[model samples]
Structures are given as C-alpha cells and as structure tokens.
Target chain A: MEEVKVYGAWGSPPSHRVEIALKLKGVKYEFIEEDLKNKSEELLKYNPVHKKIPVLVHNGRPIAESLVILEYIDEIWKQCPLLPTDPYDRAQTRFWAKFIAEKITPAVRDAMLIPGEDAEKKTEELIELLHILEKEIKEKKFVGGNRNKYMDIVSLYVIHWIPILQEYSSKHVLTREKFPGIYDWIDQVLLDCGDIMENLPDKNKMFDVLRVIFGPRNNYKPT
Target chain B: MEEVKVYGAWGSPPSHRVEIALKLKGVKYEFIEEDLKNKSEELLKYNPVHKKIPVLVHNGRPIAESLVILEYIDEIWKQCPLLPTDPYDRAQTRFWAKFIAEKITPAVRDAMLIPGEDAEKKTEELIELLHILEKEIKEKKFVGGNRNKYMDIVSLYVIHWIPILQEYSSKHVLTREKFPGIYDWIDQVLLDCGDIMENLPDKNKMFDVLRVIFGPRNNYKPT
Candidate 1:
C-alpha cells in the first residue's frame, strides 16, 4: 500500500469530506493540521493553484480539491465503494456531488461568512436551496439511497456547518419540521459514518472561527 | 445499446463538450437543438433543476451538466477513454477539468458579457488565467497528453469562443505570442476532433447570441 497523508484544516467541510472518504475506505494515513491563518509550506506546495487545504498525498504525489481527491480515493481503494458501479448511477452520483459543491456549499459559506443584509439574503437562498435538496433526498435514506455515497460526503457542509452558522447568527436555517428529509439524512449519515462523525470540530469552536474570519458584521463587505 | 439523445444549444461550449464526447466515443444519438430565446419543453422537462443545456438522455433517464455527462459517456463506451486509467492521472485530469469549469469558463464568459471598465478588468483577468493554463499545457499536446480527454473537451470555450470574443471586442485576449502553448493546444484539439469542429456554430451567430443574451454593452449589467 502506498503511504497516504492528509493535509487539512479543522472546521473545513471540504477537508472533512476527504477525511470521511479515507475513514470509510479504512485507509490509515497521517493527518497534518494546517493553521489556515498561517498555512503550512507543504499545503502551499501540494496545492499551489487553489492554495487551500485538504490535499491528499499518496506516496508523495499530492491530489488537491476534495471532490477530485475523493474520486481518486474511490478508484484506488475498491473496497467500500464511494461511487456507484453502474455508469448512469455514477453520473447521477457525480451530478449530485457537483450540485452540492456549486449550489449548497457556496450558499452555506456565504450565509455564514457574509455580514448584515447580504448574509440574511444568503441565508434565505440557502434555505431555498436546501428545500430543493430535500425533495431529491426524500426517497433515500442517504443521498445515494441506503448507502452513504459521495454526495453524502459532499453534504457534510449542510450536516455539520449549518448548525454552527445558525448558532453564530442566532437564526434557524435547518429544522426538523422544515426539512424532514435532510434532517433524517443527516442522522443516517452520522450513524453510517460514526468514526468520521466523532471527529468533526465542535460547533462552538466553528462559530468562533467563523466570527474571527468574518469579523464584525457592520464592517463586512462581500469579496 | 441504450437509446441516446442530446438536448443542446448550438453556441454553448458546455453543450459542445457533450457533443464532442458522444462523437469521440462513436455513439449514435439524436440531436435536439434548443432555442435559447425560447427553450423547448423537452429541455425544461429533462433539466428542471438548472433548466440548462445540454442534457444527455440515455434510454429514458436524463443527465444534466456537461462534465457529468462526459464521465457517463466515458464509462459506458470504453473504446475512447476520456479519463486516465491510473488513479493519480485520473485525479489530475479531473482537477484540470474542474479548473476549466470553475475558473476559466466563468472568467471568459464575464470577459465577453460584462461592459466597459468591468469587461476590461475581466479581460485582464482572463489573460492572466490563460497564462496559467498555458503553463499547465506547455509540455502536453493536449490536456490529457497525446489524446483529447475531458480537459480538452472542457477547454472548447477557450479554443472556439475566445476567438469570437477577440473578434467582437478586438481586445486580443488570447494571442499566439502571449499564449503559444494554448495556441498549439487549440490547433491540436481541433485537428484531433475535426468532426465536432466542423459542426461548431459560426462566429457571427455566436456574436449575435452574445449580443442578445448580454444586450447592448451600454445597458449591460454584470449578473
């Protein structure tokens, strides 16, 4: 087996996605925590394009971007497959993953990061997006029906990050009554991937980090 | 073989990406051209989420998003593989594909669509982005090296659309002198995939569509 190492930041949902895939595949690897404020030279070297965290180094070769890394992990480790085997099903899985990345994650991030009126608007948009996702996941126990697939891993932003955002803003973005399917799916994913679930950053710590990142709401400007 | 169909617009680079994949794989499929002014009901039904083209319908099921459809095509028809067999190589291919979709496409689109000062800024940004891509592809004949793959398909915007933007704006965003590697790549990809090249929309038609979509430059507001 090739030596594997993960460079990630705590409270990063994308990084958590990589961790979930690694844990699900039962791949033993070293974890190098990146101080996002003062990023490590290794992280920069591994991912110069984005200069972001959650880079998986396999036998010294680094792969960046969480979704791309997840696909690589799935292809290399056949046991406990992350994606469906069927071509159409795999496409569907990829579609949902892309959807989460494009729609869900950004909206959640904006809702959490932006201040004042823009944050409120982003929160509304986030809820609307979650409503659409609720319909898609209504029939399945997980995002990939019964199994916790790539989409579920991508959806860690919703399951883990939303609560932190809610606490920070003192607003309710996700509730059991409003998004029953998403709520259930969250529980199912946590139950299915307990080992990874156990290691997620604390909600209070996440809120604190977000507050520091965004600073006071009055002076915040969308970048 | 499953019944295959493509719902796409003539001037859409993403739509063209799907068409290229199907053509490269030697798959026979029906083509339904969408009118952007008034999208067909079939397109709306097939891709309700984004209501965007192109949607690749296999048998009865529909797959939206060009990159996802390309992956489906590659998986179903293995003769002309769009992704690398090696996991690391596959990851790199995916990384470039994502890079094109996220960074390159949007920058190019904004450079074309936005008006006046914003467009100038976007054009500068686009040129910078192309410089980076030039470095990535400097050593390879194509994005996949030796063959047209997913990144090459994703790069259709840069190959086909950039020239039209240059013609309209007369700003020379992607010149041979500045982007020699990209120039070589554009020629190589067109040569490698001549059939698809032959079917690309005329330059004037694309400019007209851009004009209509973005409206007059004076009135254009970046969305």
Candidate 2:
C-alpha cells in the first residue's frame, strides 16, 4: 500500500471524521497537524481551494473536504464499509450527510462571525436545522447504524462545533429535549452503554477554541 | 425486480438529476410531478423529513434528495455507472458535485431572493462561486467525467436553475469570459453532443414558473 498522509487540525470535526474513518479501515497514515491561523505550505499545496485541514494525500494524490475524504477512504480500503452496499441506503446516507455538511460551517459562522439579530436569527435557524438533523438521524446504532458511515462523520461536526455557540452566548441552542435522539446517539457513538467516555474528544478543548475565537457575547469583556 | 417510482417536480434540477440517472441507467420507473406550492400527500409521506421532490420509491422503499436518488439509482441499476469505480476519483467527482450543489441554490437564491445591495453582494459571491465551479469542473467529460455520474445528476441543479438566474438578473453568471469552461460544459450537456441533453426538460417553462412566483424582475415583464 502506498503511504497515506492526512493534513489536519487536532480538534476539527472534519479532521476527526477522517481520523475515525482511517482508524476503522486500518489504513496506516501519517498525520501532520496544522495551525489554521498560520497554514503550512503542505496544507496550502494540498488544499488550496478551501485551505482547510482534513486533506488526505494518498500516493501523492491530494483530496480535500472531509466528507470527500471519508468517501475516498471507504472506497480505497473497503475493509469496513462506511457506506451501505445497497444503493437506496447509500443515497439516504449521502442525503443526510450532505444536509449535515451544508448546515455546519454556516451555523458556526453565524455564532462566531455574524452579529446582532442576524446572529441570533441564524442561531435559531441553525437550531431548527439541528432538530431536523436529530429527527432524521433517529434510526439505528450509528447514523449509518451498527457500523459507522457518512452520517457519523457529519454527527461529529454537530457534536464538536456547537460548544462554540455556548461559550459565546451562554445559550444552549441544542436543548436536551429538543434533540434527544441525536444527543442520545452521540452518547451511543462516543460512549456506549458498556463503555463510558471513550470516543469523544475533550470537551474543554472544544470550548476553549470557541471561547478564544468567538469571545463571549461578541465582546468577551464584562461590562 | 420490484417496481420503481419517482416523485418529482417538473423543471426542477434536483428532479431532473434523478431522472437523468434513471435514463442513463435505462431503468424503468414511473414519474410523478408534484406542484411545489400544493405538494401532494404522497410526496409529503414519501419524504417525511425533507418533504421535497426527487424521491425514488423502489418496491415501497422511498429515498429522497436528488443526489441521494441518483446514488440509489446507480447502486440498484449498475448498467450505466454514475460514479467512478475508483474511490479517489469518485470522491473527487462528488466533492465538486457537492460543492456545485451547495453553491447553486444559494447563488440563485442570492440573485433572485433579495434586491439592491444584498442582491448585488450575492451576485458577486455567486460570480466568484461560478468561477470556482468553472475552474474545478474544467477537467473530464462531466463532473463525473467521460460519462454522467452522480455529479452530473447534481449538476442538473445548475442546468435547470442557472438560466433562472440569468433570466431574472438580466445577466449571465456564466459567460464565455467569466466562466468559459462552465459555459462550454453546459452547452455540451444541453446541445445533444453528449447523451445528457436528450433528457433535459425545457428551460422556458422554468422561467414561466419563476415569473409567476417572483413577478417581473429587471428585464422580463410578467403579464
């Protein structure tokens, strides 16, 4: 097998999704950590389009976009299939995955970048989107069920990114009752009934990044 | 073989995407057109989550989302391959397809939904996005390349939808100078040089729908 190299940030859901896929597939790859603020030339070279992490280089061919990377990994290794063998099921997975991917960055940007009523409005819309997400992902073990697939990768985006909203506004956009299925699903994916606190990345670190970037109430300092 | 049925909206790119996939595969299926304003119960029922069109119901199993439907169609009827056999290539195709899908909706929305500055902002962004799309899609036969794959299906979003942008805004986002590659590709897709154009629904009727819903814009005056 040719060498597989992944350029990524430590705590990004996109990066995490690729990491889990490679791990599940048992593909040996070297990881190069990137400072998003100061992007490395390798990251720039590999992913000039987005200039983001979660870029997968296999046999010197570069593929960006975490969702794209996951699909690529699934196809190459084929050890543990991330997508369903059946066409309909695979379509369902991709629909939900794309829906999830489309919502994530915008939701985060609204919370972290935008301001005023627009920010709050976008947050409300974002929460509504998450509810739709929770409703759609209520079935099976993982989003893909007993086996992890594209949906699970998308789930990481939600689980990991929402904290920034919290640190910035102290508003829990993802109220417990609102998204029980998804909240429960995350618990299942990260900490199964038999296992506790195993798969999820550190909560503190995620919050820390959010707090640093977004600040509290868009100003951070207490009046 | 179980029965195959598709519920979709006439002149919709998403709907046409699934249709193209079916046509390419030579799959036999019934097409049900739904009025977007007055959606059918069956359409709502088949896709309870999205309540949108381009739902493929195979033997009572319903799959929604045009991209998802394309994937489903390809999976079940493999005669005409919609995705590349190689994982990386497939991923690359999908990356652009997904990128195209995400941008087209918003870009069109930007051009049509608002007016003045907000609309202009969207148009500028849409132009930038179109340029990116043109550059990225420059390679291969289609987004799927050498053949119509899943990307080709999703690219219908562009074909069915882009004209609306042009018709309403009094400008073509994809012109020979700005998006020569995209202009050429769309021409190829719609001109019957490739098998893709044969299946496309009429673009004029789509303009009729937009006019009825949005009234007269910059140029075209609605009666």
Candidate 3:
C-alpha cells in the first residue's frame, strides 16, 4: 500500500471527520497540522482550489473536502464501510451528509460569526434545522439506522460544534429536551466511536481557536 | 429492475443533471414535473427534509438532491458509468462536482439574485471562479479527461446558464477567448449527450422563467 497522509487542523470539524474516518479504517498515516493562517506550500499545492484543511494525500494524489475525502477513504479501505452498500441507503446517507455540510455547518458558522441580535437570529435558524434532524434521527439509532455510517460521521460537526457555539454565545440553541433524538444519537456515536471521542480537540483549545477565529463575545473571553 | 421515476422542474439545472444521468445510463423513468409555485403532495412526501425538486424514486423509494440522485442512478444502472471506476479518479470527479455545486452554483445564484451593483460584484466573482475551472479543463478534453463524466454533468449548469445570464444582464461573463477550454468542453458535452440537449428547456422559455423568478432588470424587460 502507498503512503497515506492527512493535512488538517485540530479544531476544524471537517478535519476531525477525516481523522475519524482514517481511525475507523485503522489506516496508519502521517498527520500534518496546518496553520490555517499560514497554510503550508504542500497544502497549497495539493488543494489549490479551496486551500482548505483536511486534504487526504494518498500516495502522491490528494483529495480535498472532508465529505469527498470520507467517500474516498471508504472506497479505498473496505473495512467497516462508511457508506451503505444498498444504493437507496447510500443515497439517503449522502443526502443527509450534504445537508449537514451545506446547511448545518454554514448555519453554525453564521451563528458564531455574527454577534448580538443577528447571532441570536441565526441561532434560532440553527435550532430549527436541528429540529428537522431530530425528527429524522428519532426512530433510528444512528443516522444510517442501526449502525454508524457516513451521516453519523458528518453529524459529528453538529454534535461537537453546537455546544462550543452555545458556550461562546451564552445562548442555548440545542437543548436535550428539544433535540432528544440528536442527543441520543450523539451519545450512541460517542459510545461506539471511542477513538473519535478520545481524539477530539480539547474543549478549551476549541474555545481558544473559536475566539481567535470568530472573536470573543459576551462573557466569552480568550484564554 | 424496479420502476424509476424523476420528479423535477424544467428550468432547474439540478433537475437537468439528473435527467442527463438517467439518459446516459439508458434508464427508463417516468418524468413527473413539479410546479415550483405549488409543490405537489408527492414531492413533499418524498423530500420532506429539503422539500426540493429533482428527487429520484426507485421501487417506490425516494431519493432527493440532484447530485445524490445522479450517484444513485450511476450505481443502480451500471450500463454507462457516471463516475470513474478508479477510486482516485472517482474522488477527483466528485471533488469537481462538489466544487461546482457548492461554490459555482451559489455564486451564479448570487449574481442573478442580487440586483445592480451587488449583482455586478457577484458576476465578477463568478468569472473568477470560472477562470479557475478553465485552467483545470484546459489540458483535458473533458472535465475528467477523454470522457463525459460526473464533472461534465455538473458543469452543464455553467455552460448552459452562463449564456442565459449574460443575455439577461447584458454582461458577457463567459466568453470563447476567456474560457476556450470550457467552450470546447461544452460543445463536446452537447455533441455527446444529445439527449440532454434535446430535452433541455428552450432558451427563451428559460429566460422567461428566469425573468419571472428573478424579475426583469437592466433594460431586459419581461416578455
């Protein structure tokens, strides 16, 4: 097998998603931490289009976009398939994953990026979106149903990032009662994927990065 | 083989994408046109999450989101592969397809949705993105090289919609000189995928739809 490498940032959910996929696949590779402020030449060369973190370099070729990387990893490493074999099931998983990437991730960014009433408005929108997910996950143990799959991996961003955003904003957007299914799903995913839980960036480090990236807000000061 | 059905709108690029994929695979599907103004119960039932069009139903199971549907069509109907067989090549194809969906589509939407100075600003952004794509396509006969693949299907939006947008705005965002590779690629795609060309909604009808949806502007009065 050719050498595998991952270029990513510790605090980025997309990066973490790639790491989780790699870990689950039990693929040994080099982990290069990127200073997003000063991206490395290698990162620039590999992912010139987005120049974003979480570029998986397999052999000499590189794949960008966390979701795209996840798909690649699944395709390359057959052990513990991230996506379902059934075409319809795979479509559903991809649909939810795309939803998370396109809708949930951006909504969270908006909630954190904007301040004051605007942030609150965005938070409300985020909660509404979570409610939609809650309905979907209510009956299923995991996003792919009865097993962890691509949707579960992508949902990690929502599960992990939402609490950090709440802590930063001092506003509770995702409540246990409101999103019970989501909370249950998170607990199940964490219980199943111990590696992901263990490898997640420390909360304080996440907060520090968030403050640096988005700036501090009420009662949320940089440490 | 199970019954296949496509729920789509004529003027939607995403819808066209699904149509092209099905055609390329030679899959017979019942086409159900949904009125965007008043979406049918079936569309809502099938795609409750997004409540959007371009849903593919197979054996009474529904799959929403155009890109996801494209993948589903490719997977089930293996007669003509939409994605490359090699894992890495598939990853590259997916990366570009995602780039088109996430970055290029939204930029074009912004150009059309925003009015006056804002629209022009977005138009400039769109052109910059197109230039990036042009560089990628310059060396290759098609997006994925030597064949019409997923990237070409997604790029259909840029090829078809850019001219219509230029007509409406009276601003040539895409030109033969500026985007010769893209023009060549478009010609090739149209030449190869005659079904896509034949099934595409008329340009004037598309313009009428755009005017109705986006409203007439800059001396481009609604007919």
Candidate 4:
C-alpha cells in the first residue's frame, strides 16, 4: 500500500494544516482533491460521523478531523516534531491549538455578519479574539516559540484566507496594524513554507462556492 | 504548597471526570467546591479565559478544561495509566475523548429544552449521537479499551446524570438494552469510583439551581 494519502478540498485551512505538516515532515502520499460541492462516496464513507474534508488515509486506514490527522501524521513521522517534547510545553501548545479550533468558528461568524445586527457585537468579539491571538503570538517565527510548529501551521498561517473573508464582508478584520505579531507570523510562515499561498485554491473561487451556504453582505468571496 | 488541589462543583460531569481520574490514579487531593452561581474569585483568576469550574491547581499552577486536567493528573500521578502507552492507541483515545467533549454540550442542550416541540427532532439527533457512542463502545469494557479507561471517566461514567436526562426528556436515548457494553462500563466505573455519587449533590436540589438560569419549565415541577 502507498504510505499516506490525503482527501481534501482545495479551500479548507483544516486540509492545508495536514498538507503543510506532511510536506514539512517529508511524508510521501497521494493527494486526492475532493470536490466538496459534490462530495465523493469515499470521503463520506471514511468520515461518516462528521462527513467533512481533510480526511487523511494512511496505510489504508482513514483518520478524520484535521487535529486528529495532524496528530496521526506527527506520530508516524518524527523528522520534524510539530509539537514540543516537554509534557508541559506539549500541553500548552495543545491548549492553544484547542482554543483556536473551538473559537475560530465564532470569530469568523462575527466577522461576516451585518454590523449592529448581532453581527456588530460579534465583530467586536472577533477583534478581542484577534487581540488574544496577537498577545500570545509575536514577530517570533511561530506561535510555538521561534519554530515552524503546529500552532503556527494552523493559526498564524491560515489567515491567508482573510482576503476572501474581507471581500465577502466588506470589512477588514486582519490589518497588519492591529496585530503586528500575528501579521509577521503570517509573512514568516509563508516564507518558511515555500509557495504555501500557491497551495491554497484561488480565493475568489472558494468564496463564491461557499456564498450559497454562508449568506450575503458578509459572505465569503474568495480573493 | 500542598500535594494537589481541585476546584470543582458537585455533579458536574467535567469536574467529576477530574475527580474520577484522580481516584483511579490514587492521588489524594483536596476538593474545593465552587458554587457556580456564586463562583469563587480564585477560580475566576485561575481560569480567566473560561472561568468555568474543574480547575486543577498543582502546587501553584492551574490547569483548566476537564480533558486537559485529566491528562495533567495522569502525567503528574502516573500510577494507573488512563491512556494507552502506544502512540496510535493514545491518539485514538484522544480522538474519542475530544469527540465526546465536543458533543456533550449539544447533547445536554437537547435534554434541557422543552420536549415534544421541535425537541422531537432534536431528540432524534440526540439518539443518533448516542447510537454513534453505542457503536464505538459496543460491548467493550470501556470507550478506550478492555479495561475502564479515561474515556469512560470523561464521558458517561462521570454522572448518573444520564438517568436524569432520560427521565426529564422522556425519550430515554441511552439505556442498557440499547448499549449493554456501555452499561457494563457504567457498572465497572461505579465500582472503581465508590462513594463519588454520595459526593455529588442531589440532582433534585440541582434542578432548583438550574431552573433559575434555564427559566421556568411548565408542566413538570421538581417533585
């Protein structure tokens, strides 16, 4: 059997997290592009519980969820550790990673909704979230202290899709001025992961696809 | 500094999860119950982000979130290993642990809302969730593996609250008939963590506390 295979849509940050980690770890695998609009039976079969993308099939066994996939990838390949070795440090990284995963949905929701219509309150909440993100991260290369780590691969790096969110919402949530640390983390991660931007499907194309599901005025229109 | 201290609330599954883990690992720790209605200032400071209960303060440092605290306790004590030693097994346990945690809120929400309205639909969704649980845990000693493990502690084993949900919702989603292995797990964990139930506050009494927040529920008085 082939070593590793990833079932992913071109647009999802969750998929990219696994992709970048696999590339960084030099894990060889087939890449399957799942058209999320018309999801394949294979993807559905693999991840029946959530039925979502970023399903990593390794050695014929499929692991669903990006975090689950990331952990699985880290376990098999030890070339470059995505997480710190110290138990406390590992916990700290995990705490932040979990925090981001739990909070990101609400953050984006707040960013996209109409101002003053519950959306306004959410937008403020989103800024507060960004502020926390800024406080935790810095100009230092990664969220995990000066290295290209999992936290950075997921958090600081994923905001490359912000332009799409902004185009849809008509409001800029992630200007460099408000969060220089996060901003620098973004630039550094792009440099660190060569041609990472190119890996993401065209932003405008992705946003258009999601608009039917996400709503207008603050809808997602890929860059 | 004392050996270890847990700030918790009576009968809360998250806090109970921590308590069970501590008992299984044979860790002697002082339990400080925080009346969630009137939360302690100390808890606010320790878990500033969430400010919710079940904070494990070892020496001076505090760890928030039940799953995180469970891992912390396992690492600090290291006697009765709650998680598997192998990385694959550990990852699988973590995956289910997270899945359960993510859904507990939604499941509990279903049980709380007025039944027989749109709640019928929500209840079916709830049953579907339990079926997933039932399938994953089919006839096994516990969610993790052969022996009663962390997944049991963190998931259903923490509370007899399932009975409370069944009675209140009148749907009886989780039961021994449908899920015998899990029922067996319930029996084992109850044996393992003796008298923890006595430690839990009366559910009838807790209803009085929750009713104020949830607003009055007509037709069914806490008799």
Q: Who wins the lDDT comparison?
A: 3
Model 4 misplaced stretches (Cα beyond 4 Å): A113-117, A138-148, A156-158, A195-198, A204-223, B1-3, B113-117, B139-148, B157-159, B168-171, B178-181, B188-223
Better-scoring candidate (DockQ), 1 or 4: 1
Stretches of model 2 off by over 4 angstroms after superposition: A104-115, A118-127, A133-150, A158-169, A173-180, A192-200, A217-223, B112-114, B137-147, B157-164, B190-196, B221-223
Q: Which stretches of model 3 miss by more than 4 angstroms?
A: A139-144, A220-223, B139-146, B217-223
Q: Report lDDT (CA) for all predictions.
A: 0.79, 0.71, 0.81, 0.71
Query: For residues B49-106, what per-residue lDDT tens digits would candidate 2 score against the true structure?
Result: 6788878889997888766666667777779688878776787777777677766676
> Residue-wise lDDT of candidate 3 within B1-223, one digit each (tens)?
6698899998888998998888888888899999999999999998888899988888988888888888888888888777888888888888888888879888877876555667768888888898888988885443347454677788888778777877776677788988998888788878877666777777788777777877776767544
Model 3 C-alpha RMSD vs. true structure (Å) is 2.4
Candidate number with the higher lDDT (3 or 4): 3
What are the per-residue Cα lDDT tens digits for candidate 4 across A78-167?
A: 888897765555656666777777785557755663355576778888788777778767522333474537776777434666656666
Point out the worst 10-residue segment of candidate 4 chain A by lDDT: A139-148
DockQ of each: 0.81, 0.67, 0.89, 0.43
Among these predictions, the greatest TM-score belongs to: 3
lDDT of 1 by residue, A79-135 (tens): 988887888778878887888888987887677666456766888888888887887
Winner of 1 and 3 under lDDT: 3
Q: Whole-model lDDT for model 2 versus the true structure? A: 0.71
What's the DockQ of model 1? 0.81
> Of models 1 and 4, which has the larger lDDT?
1
lDDT of 1 by residue, B73-172 (tens): 8988899788777787788888888888889888877886564677678888887878778877875443346444776777777888878776665566
lDDT of 4 by residue, B1-223 (tens): 4568899987577888888788777878999999887999999987766789989888776778888788777776788788777665666677777777777556656655544477767777777776776766663323346443676666553247766655544456677887776676677767876654555556686666556656555544566
Q: Give the TM-scores of the predictions, in the order they appear.
A: 0.91, 0.84, 0.93, 0.84
